[model samples]
Target: MSTREEILFELGITPRWKLRDVAEIESSEETSSSEDLHKGAISSNASGDWSELKTTIESCDRCKLCESRKKVVVGVGDPAANWLFIGEGPGAEEDERGEPFVGRAGQLLDNMLLAMRLNRRENVYIANVVKCRPPGNRNPEPDEVDACSSFLDQQIDLIAPQVIVLLGKVAAHRVIGGDGTLASYRGVEHRYKNISTVVTYHPAYLLRNQLDKAKAWKDLCFAMDLMDKKIEQRK
Candidate 1:
């Protein structure tokens, strides 16, 4: 505590707060308030209460990425999807369409799903580790990714999919603990809160590399196999 900071603290100025710091403080306050407001003893109510949270994210100013967004790109796919796909974030087509995976990459994904007897929009639900697009399709900044993570958590809670397939290094990094190598992480099963999760190469990566599609296919097959096993075990 410098003399100036001490005095400012007494005056409640926080004059030293940078734009980023001020934004973070405001975000913290808002989160605290929301937690208090949603403090029901029942876990079901807390688990189910995300409509308001989603709306708040739609108009969020918590990060600089929000400034460039055309639409919120909340998420897409069946709310009750047995298989959930988590990716890095929205790409150009996703941003333009306000849904995840709608470009050439998306086409490849569609074909891959169709082969597995799954439909992109009907059978499977898709979300991103992030809800916003990075500028120039670059990777999300760490701070930006952190800021939007709770939204993904909420999506996972609402869906409660039997298996989660994390596509690409980014989603895998968040969902599966590792040294951040897709090669190392893919095809392995991990626990995400409660659901079974596997990491896979993104469809976009498959489109670019082509060869990796074989590997991606294998990962998807593993996910489906596990899903079936779970069902059989339950029965």
Candidate 2:
């Protein structure tokens, strides 16, 4: 199969000609002393400290999510990635695996990353607004998001990514902070911690609404342009 076809097959999506035309895309903390982190004491020096952060998340009880979760999906990928993708929260597969995006949705995400010439293990990082899987894979409550805010914040500081792609409404609401629909947030550049941010449907959503994959592709193109501009500004 052709490279493009292979990607579509992996995504389990059929090629949309317009999307094909735009075929471009775009795509932590550390603990500290446990007490310090639990008390919301983020160490400035803790930026890029993955080990400490992982320890904290594993034992986190900041919200009810920790109560039922099998494992904490701390996040995965390059510590100092240029691209950061944030999602809502972990699901059953992710909770069991202790990693984010390992199910079919994750497979689609991988294909999406591949389309953008990025990879989770490369200069890209993937995380969620909340570390633990919500019971029944439901949307995380505001308090749950509030509980994990500091951890996610520390991750942003540590990664210092030039561009962030919020992979659904929950992430957009948590990161960008407004009562906006996912469509309203798309096609525009938002800022979080001064990092350029783009919003798009989550891979899981895309799987359910295949027709929207074209829209997702367009969002990705916008994100790619944002990333390109950021790179240019650095130069």
Candidate 3:
């Protein structure tokens, strides 16, 4: 298959071909036990702090993805950043490198952040709803999401970001909790633990449908504007 075909396949879009075409596509744990594990862990680890949270993620075996991951992608960028970017999970490349958003999709995300005059190492941090890659790049299951939700919550508490950009369906579904489409989630600032949240297309999705980059840009700008408001409120 060619590069175009591969991308289409990855996105699960059917390809047009000469008698042949194809495309395909495609957590956490908790305290020992809790209804909202991450929520609880966020409070408990508040005192344990960032290092404890990172160590927990790195050594986590709350879910089966841990069995297969080469290295757990904890997160990256400013620990105290005002901007936080959360995606679905680590992809193959991310799993290999033990970092989130470091592949083709990552490059696009970097460009998007640069457009906002931000970079991961400075004013922004990047992470995933799930730390480990789902086998075969598939969407993470509910059990997996539940298992890993606490780690994410802990990360959020530590960073205390002013605005959260939830990229793609999984992040939206996990954080926002709805059956609505991604369109429904966009253009509105929802609240997750009282922090402003904006939903947007994942960079991987933008890689396939370049047209949506405009919409994603709008989402990013909205997030930036919200962050500005949050900063002013603090002052």
Per residue, candidate 3 scores C-alpha lDDT tens digits across 94-134 of: 99999999999998787776555567797578999999999
lDDT of 1 by residue, 82-159 (tens): 778888989887888888888988866776665455677764778888788898999887888889888888788877
Off by over 4 Å in 2: 8-47
Give the range where candidate 1 is weakest over 10 consecutive residues by summed lDDT: 37-46
lDDT of 2 by residue, 106-170 (tens): 98898888766667897788999999999888999999999999999989888887789999999
Model 2 TM: 0.84
Q: How accurate is candidate 3 locally (lDDT)?
A: 0.77
Which pairs, if any, clash in model 3? 9-23, 9-24, 27-147, 27-148, 28-147, 28-148, 29-147, 38-150
| Best of the candidates, lDDT | 2
lDDT of 1: 0.70
lDDT of each: 0.70, 0.79, 0.77
The predictions' CA RMSDs to the true structure, in order, are 21.8, 9.4, 13.5
All candidates: TM-score: 0.77, 0.84, 0.79
Clash counts for the predictions, in order: 0, 3, 8
